[model samples]
Target: MKRIVEFMKRNYKIILVVTALSAILWSFIPREKKEDPEKDKLILELLTMVLERGHYSPVEINDDFSKKVYHKYLENIDPTKRFFIQSDINEFSKYETSLDEMILRKDISFFNLTNSRLLQRMKESRKIYENLLSKPFDYNVKESINIDYDNLPFAKNKSDLVERWRKQLKLSTLSSLTDKQKLEEEKKKENASYEEKSFEVIEKEVRESTLKSLDEYFNFLEKELTRDDWFAIFLNSIVERFDPHTFYFSPEDKEKFDVSMSGTFQGIGARLQKKEAGVEISELISGGPAWRGKELEAGDLILKVGQGKEEPIDIAGMRLDDVVKKIKGPKGTEVRLTVKKVDGTIKVISIIRDEVETEETFAKSSVVEKDGKKYGIIYLPKFYISFENKENRDAFKDVAAEIEKLKAQNIDGLIMDLRDNGGGSLETVVKMVGLFIPEGPVVQVKAPRRNPEILPDPDKRVQYDGPLVVMINNFSASASEIFAAAIQDYKRGIVVGSKHSYGKGTVQNVIDLNQFIRSSSFGDLGALKTTIQKFYRINGGSTQREGVKSDVVFPDRFSYLDMGERDEESALPWDKIEPAKYEPLQINYDNIILNSNKRIATNTTFKLIDENAKWIFERKDEKVISLNLNDFNNELAVADEKLKKFKAISDYKNTYEFKSLPDELALFEKDTVLKQKRERWHEEMQKDIYIEETLNIISDIKLLTKGKSLTQKLSLN
Candidate 1:
């Protein structure tokens, strides 16, 4: 550890010196002067108009304040600029006082503060003004002006007398009601006809309702003031001082996010979700310790966790983060959880936490048979690999191995499933794409004032030569986009799935918190994730706001949800540059769509999807009926009947006759589908209809190539 610290100290000083020099240079630098006075004046006029519309009082024109803000704005605009130079900065500085005056007078001509730096400065100045207005005021000693709780002027001072006066004014306003207020006051006029005694009953009901409302308001406030909330807010405040991408995560959130990103964690292997009753087991991760134990099942609500059955720790009303911390322990430790099953049975299950290896998250392959032809299917959960670790375990290498194994089995075609894969290592993605096509430009990257550079495939050889199809969905993003773009650009395979992928093109670098505070007065402030660069396709279009559009599209339940880059707050803007020149791949897959549409039109599974979507849409927000025992039983029966009908439509029995293959071929096929329902499970794995469509396309490609080969042989004969 000491050696490691020494090494970092030796290398990190260079970065510190460079950063310090840049900051010092920027602080003293004179920036460009504004050539367009009209533009500058328009910006100022706009700011004034916005202030007036918002009912914000303008700041008094102070030359010192204006000059200080203007200089700060210049520094923000071009932090690297040094020496007394540049006309734009100088010109903007010259009109600083005039801008302040225009803002103070609420001039209509001020409307052009559109630049980011200028906007930030204007916001800061407005905040200063508001802070000044929010100061406590002395309401006790009033001149002739009317001043009460409801009609008090903005305060600008803090004093003990002011607090007493404000409280006194609030009490007086309640005591002395105005004519308008009295006219609109709540009255028991309806009860006057009934009796004077009935007024007491009405008053009690109104008081109870008001009390309930207040109780709910305070409950919400209490929940909002949790330790986690305060910690999150503090972290955010610290991160906000730096770039928008830089962030801090508490230990719990950090653990969760790390688990999601890496797809590995120390747990019993059950996926949990917060349900109405308690944390319920959603699914059992295959090959996990929990799955091996077979003691826990999906839909079992965990009520308590305990050690040695000594009084269980009730987890009701506990935050998910807190619950997770309690459940996660070192490997080999046994933690018992009392669960309530859906069938109304209670059971205590002891689970041992262990390191769950997530092979499912990597590349897994299977053979699919449709219309008496076999197609290889490779499901890649994410383009993930820990590059920092010395262990060479990588996604690209694993995927390449899977492809080679499929090749050895003499598969006719291939389907690469990328559905719900929210991307990872950019280096791995480029290498993965290289497995299909000969080495060429896969992507391009550009930064401010820098020429765009092409990121080419590092390898020169193709791993698989047979027909190929790439599957994607709405959740597919970043590295996924890069892979899809490369495959599309090369025309090496059919790109099929949702209409567009999740457009997350920005790259983030995780800066250690300890490293950041090493030279500062504060020690170990926590980690910071800073956005370093952006990703672009080889075609010059960014996959930022506009993700990759598929050649064939499929429907998904989450299609209506706002889940992409455009929906994200503070996402970077999308733009393009000159297209990089490259020859497109020679493969043809136009017939894939024609065949897919025909199959989908007659498919019963797809028909159920359409019907279910319509049903959900119609009953999306229907309130539950408060029914008696008989009516409740009747409602449950109706719901069960509807579910049965939906299930029937989706259940398709296999009717294709099996042919006896050669002994070697038979063994290979048997081993692939040794488990019960293997064929059906493989079919469901191709849930994205567009991916199924792609597989069909690959089948057609194989036939077309085979036909051409036979024709050439006949011609030679």
Candidate 2:
């Protein structure tokens, strides 16, 4: 390790030179200038607008604040510039006396300082501005000029009110707080008469409220800090000197982001979030302590967690990070959580800490009957199984086991629901696809300047070769797309659901910024999420800007929402590559389409969805106002009426009453849906309107095959 370190140190200069050259070359590359000057201008305008008109009370602006904000913007754009260095600082020092005047005089040329040195000075100016704004100010003061309170309405409570006030105060007090201080002192004295309380009571109240208020304030601060306006400014300062992805993370944010990306942390295996009322159980990770205990459920709000009943710590208004720290401990330690169930009942659940196994994220299936026909319904919440922990129980294995159980029931068709599945392990997806396809490449991954690697099916044998229908929605992404793409490419199954999946085609590689930073300067900073690779379908089309368009689209309200990859800033452009070669499975889709038309025409659910979509569109942009008490009540009545109409249309099947096949009669069921699918895989491959259409196509093929067999026997006679 020492030798390797020595070698890296010795070759560090070479690496830096190579990196610098690459950066220079990439910067100059004559690619299509996708840079939107309008967007850049809009960003600048937005920043200016936000600073000018934002909720900051007693809004004020000064040359110092303007310069700092401007510097922040520049830094966000480019962080690695030498303008942050001492030499550049010294250069800016020469212009220090005239800098404010230059800014006030609107001297555009003043900004034309050399890129490296100017960036450094801008960074310094940004810090100065931040420090100036950080000083306390009177948020309640109303500015005569530039009064904007657009976001003030969104403040729902006292805490939100305070946040709005703080935003205004920060803007107004920018470098001019002496007057504000005087006003605050005067206001305090004026209020002192009405607010007469004993000093002891006041102190006690202050001390008691401090923690809760601080927690609320920090929560608000976190949201404010993460806002695009603030983040852009923050990043602009640092990124100007480093890579675009490099970022500073507060300790709290760093931990949360890490847990989000990794999906596992050293905890009791329960996901919790701080809600308006209290800390709530977001999810009980399977095989985790909470999950193994089988006492907690999603939506169970946590009131407290402690070693014993008496020592319970009230977690109300606590930051999620802090709550997590309290709950998580070394494996085998006991932690008890007092929880309120969704039904209004409260209970205490004790769980022992252990490594959480995220294998059961995907739901297993069993055969159920609808109109006396046995069907396999596999409920997949998210296409997740840990690739990092492949040895033990996982999604693929569990799903396979469920499929086998369904097969034992001799089911005719399969419904693989991908709705709300945000996607997970690419490896599990490949293996899951392999269960359907007979040993072939499932998906292709392409990296920069490298040939695409094909992830082939892991299994050689097919399992339960039946009519397969993949259910998807707008939430489906990444691994979900991979599975859908492969199934579609092979003509293996029909895709069903929303207009398209979430277009998250590119992958992110997390870089621990703390590791790269000089330890002496900043300690334990956060990580940077950098775009590393893009995933493409085996058929060459990317699930990038354009997500996977389903074969059979379903109506969803979110269809109108601008959600997915294209909406994200700095998202990589989408393009196609040469398609991978594979043997195409011939399917008779003509009949399937014909059948789909008939089913869709008759399906009450589809009709209601269409009507709902139309209604939604009609009122999409309608501004609702309810000033009077009667108007508010009437509006609510109208909303409830609409909901009632929807509920009336919904034909909710009794899921619990749905029966599974008995074990005794399973094997001899030759005419079952599963048997027919295996017999007619080729014929059904074409008509995948939904998996049911595929099944219908298979049934037709079976009839055709049976007819041909009879004809052959008659000919022999």
- Global Cα lDDT for candidate 2: 0.52
Candidate 1 lDDT tens digits, 1-717 = 000000111123235533554454345322444333332232233223222221111223467545544443333322322111233344345556564564455342322331433334323433332332233322233222222212232222323224333343222222212211222333435344533334334333333433333333234334443434333432332232222344445544555655655667887876675533457775565556776675787657786666543434545444445556667777888878878654333567898888776765567677667766777778776676775574857789988988887776677888888865667777788889888877688888654345777778899788886677788776677788889988887777678876788787766554443331114222223343444457688888999878888886655443444446765433567888777887675445666667776776687776666565455455433333322323433444575576676665445434322222233245655665323223333545534355455656777777766623211112211
Winning model by lDDT: 1
Worst 10 residues of 2 by lDDT: 1-10
Superposed Cα deviation of residue 662, candidate 2 (Å): 9.0
lDDT of 1: 0.54
lDDT of 1 at 583: 65
Q: After superposition, how far is residue 190 of candidate 2 from its true place, in Å?
A: 46
lDDT of each: 0.54, 0.52
What would the TM-score be for candidate 1 when compared with the true structure?
0.56
lDDT of 1 at 283: 56
lDDT of 2 by residue, 443-484 (tens): 777655556677788887887566667777766777787888
Q: Which ten residues in a row have the lowest lDDT in candidate 1?
A: 1-10
